[model samples]
Target: MSPRQTLTSLIVGLVLPSMAAVAAGKCERLVVTGSPDAPPYLWRDPQDPKHLMGANADLLKEAATQMGVKVELLFAGKRSQALEEVRSGRMDLLADTPLNTGELESLDFIHPPIAQNEIMVWTRVGHAQPFNSLAELSGHAGAMSEKTRVTPTFENTIKEHLTLAKQPNLTQAFQQLMLGQAEFVLAGRYAGLALTQTLGMSKDLQAQPLPVDTPGLYLALSFNSACNDPWLRGQLAKKMTELAASGRSSEAVARNLELWKAQLQQPASTPNQ
Candidate 1:
């Protein structure tokens, strides 16, 4: 072959394999999980309990799509169980979860977070009162989902000062407040709003205007994930950070709320296969 043709062929052989290696570094398949009842953020698909859907799901799907990866969102029972699945490496990705020690050890958290969750107080309609801060919550019984985690500062003090009840899930926590069994319930602002609508409890409860804590919700990658390579983590983090900074996450949240609103109106006629 001519020297020019030989040089071109040599360059193609070298460059193409490097490109292939870089592409192969990405995670091809991702199994993501999230809360089964937390809406706006994530929740089990009503028609298919084993699958999940919501804002976080939407964001993850788009991010995974951008990376040419396939995403499978599953519901592994309750929140704690879902977390355990991720921790145990049974799941590759956790779409919406908070930062904590246990998770920190087993997972690589992507930032900036997909969404900022502002937790607030919820009470029965007529029983609602001015709640400016957690200090104002003293002497009142508070309820929150057993799966929910509070900030270190809030937990340190709230644990010692308040009679906070941990219900099995969001529905139960809100139910406790509505039944007068608890004076106030702690939950996410958008999630709470979405829950009330979905559960048909909008007229029965009220959330205080002030937030208790503003925590960012992240997409966590399990340390043992099959797709937990540097390329996967870096790409996912970059996409998630863009979504967070560009307000795409917020827009997705608003869009997902409407999706949930529509889902709430649908009749349950289909079952998961």
Candidate 2:
């Protein structure tokens, strides 16, 4: 490892003891909630429908392990309800969310992002050109999931120029695109890939080379969290920074992508009688 990497490793190694002391004094465990529909990052655990599992879960479990604190990701409800639970202090942490000034009042955001993902436009294999920007799709009718969140800037830009076809999720948005109901579908790169492959439509879809939006997924600690103090925040920041520099988040995404793909490859089992 390089000198910088070595230093990071050392810092990370030393974090747990300090964190353990602080956690012992203030908090016992952390309750986290995340969006269950977002695949590759987080989704409902198949074994236990009420819990979450995926790359985000993997990462959170590792982080909690490093911090010497117990963490449980509960299915509080849908995305909106989950956010409400975190905001009201019924939950301690939220797995992933965008950094918005509006949320700062109730949440303490870690600086480095926990994960990063991109929203890209998908078109029929040969239909997509050497795409570069959203402006390239100016007059084409684009499809998107209403559940997908884009920056306000991108949203306004799309509204002004693109004929967007909104659907409930990436799978349906791509369905619309493939059937010629829409020219393109705006969806997350990894999530879209998994959904298209799961739907057995990967051969027909192509994600545009350029991204419409590239947002870093943040882990926000509720302001009401008992561990949402200076020490906890600082320690979490250090760990996050180390993870980012080490490319752990990216690796987690890639690892989960293969897992998702493997699931699609499995034969359909009989439904419960």
Candidate 3:
């Protein structure tokens, strides 16, 4: 072929593939699943129907934007449903899950924990005596979410006293506590506090630090995701490191805490306790 004809062919091949790649990128989408019940972590605001606004949601959105990906939020009915979505490849990512869920076998997690969640004992104020250890609560009624995983240390011990409440959300559990249906509820500190306030039960209940379980939460990707691109995980990991180093992560957590405190009408000093 003539030199001019060969140059024209090379230009066409490069430009066509470049345009095709641009089109393909536009079609790529990220689907995230979360439940509205996990306040301070994942919750739905009536003002924003399409958006789930919370600490975990904000962090995931920031990470996605930083990686130049488009995100779509899906509301799963429960934690179990969300996990099923990830396992079935219906959801691409699950943000803010405790490490003990045994989810690692079906998902790849970003390094560096997203947050530390403490499992605290919530009881009606002046109703039950505070206990220093789980053993002290033996034979007393306790409430726990269905299929919830506690650390092995407390799992067996608490199981003996667990009442197996069927409440769908933390707010409901708090309501149960107020009505004398449950002696105490087991939940994360941030979430339990948020629900107690939102449901107008803050004055009726209080949470004490328990010697239960605590675990690091992580952003995880479904193993069956169509885009199992290792680079995406690397990018997210890098962004998380940057956020932590810049103290942005801490600021975000503090901001969320403040919001929850205000919603609960509780004193900011309560966080220190």
Candidate 4:
């Protein structure tokens, strides 16, 4: 064969496959939904109404980039609305959800936990401890969100003492506690600390780390969505593990905590009010 013809054939062979691979990787934009109530976990920035930039938001943004996907944040009015969006295929990802049997039919959860949350009790600065043991919460009044899940003994015991309220979000739960409507409230340590600071209640409330329970938080994808992309999930999982191993994730968490502390020191102004 002539040298020019040989070179032309080789170029076509390489370019055609490259073009095919690029087309295959192209994905439709995805929407991630969460309520504005969960501050520092999944809350909107007051300064940027369209932007969500908390610890969980940062983590998910990193994960999506690593997975080669484009995502937009959809702030639901309530947690139930967010869940409904996911179930109906209106949303793609739901970060930081606990494993719930009811959701399994419509959702496929990622395997390893993206994060773990230490459930703790928050009370007024000088209030007596709500319960000495997980068993002790059986009869007392405590506030927990309708969507929160308490595992094992704590779950069963708290069921009786719980007062299900229509606060609809974590921010409202904190408000309920502040208004003396509930004896105690349950929240993740990192999340609760950040929210308390954001709400300017650090001096008015105290977080007492309880040994009641801890739950692994996972990333959830809707089964009904066209983008049920496990390959993307795998990429994100690997990147997250790398971030955790290199201590970058921890550093980010610490930096966010310091930022929250500084926010707490500022004069109180409600971000979403």
TM-score of each: 0.82, 0.85, 0.71, 0.71
lDDT of 2 by residue, 1-273 (tens): 999999999998899788887657665588999787676887766668789877888887897788877889888878899899999898999898877778999999888888877988888889835556766889877788877767767878888988887886666777787789988888889878877777778898978777879877788999887768776677778888888888888899999887766665577521110
**Which parts of model 3 are misplaced by more than 4 Å?**
1-29, 100-102, 145-156, 160-166, 244-247, 257-273
Range of the 10 consecutive residues with the lowest summed lDDT in candidate 3: 264-273
State the lDDT of candidate 3 residue by residue for 1-273, as single tens digits. 999999999999999998887556452578887665555666555446555556777776787787788777777756788878887888887777765557778988887766656788888888647655676666666666643345665666565655456465565666677778888888877667666665667788887756367766677888888755666778778887776677666566667766656644544322211
Q: What TM-score, to 2 decimals, does candidate 1 have?
A: 0.82
User: If both were scored by lDDT, which would come out higher, candidate 1 or candidate 3?
Assistant: 1
Q: Write the per-residue lDDT of candidate 1 for residues 1-273, one digit (tens) a residue.
A: 999999999999999999998777767788889777667788788778789998889888888888889999999988788888988889988888877666688889887788778888888887746667777889888888865656667778777888898877787887777778989888878767877777788999888888888777788888888788888888888897778678888888899888777776678522110
Candidate 2, lDDT over the whole model: 0.80
Candidates 2 and 3 compared by TM-score, better number: 2
Model 2 residue 197 CA deviation (Å) reads 1.8
Order of candidates by TM-score, top first? 2, 1, 3, 4
- Span of ten consecutive residues with least summed lDDT in model 1: 264-273
- Top of the candidates by lDDT: 1
- Give candidate 2 regions above 4 Å deviation: 1-24, 128-130, 264-273
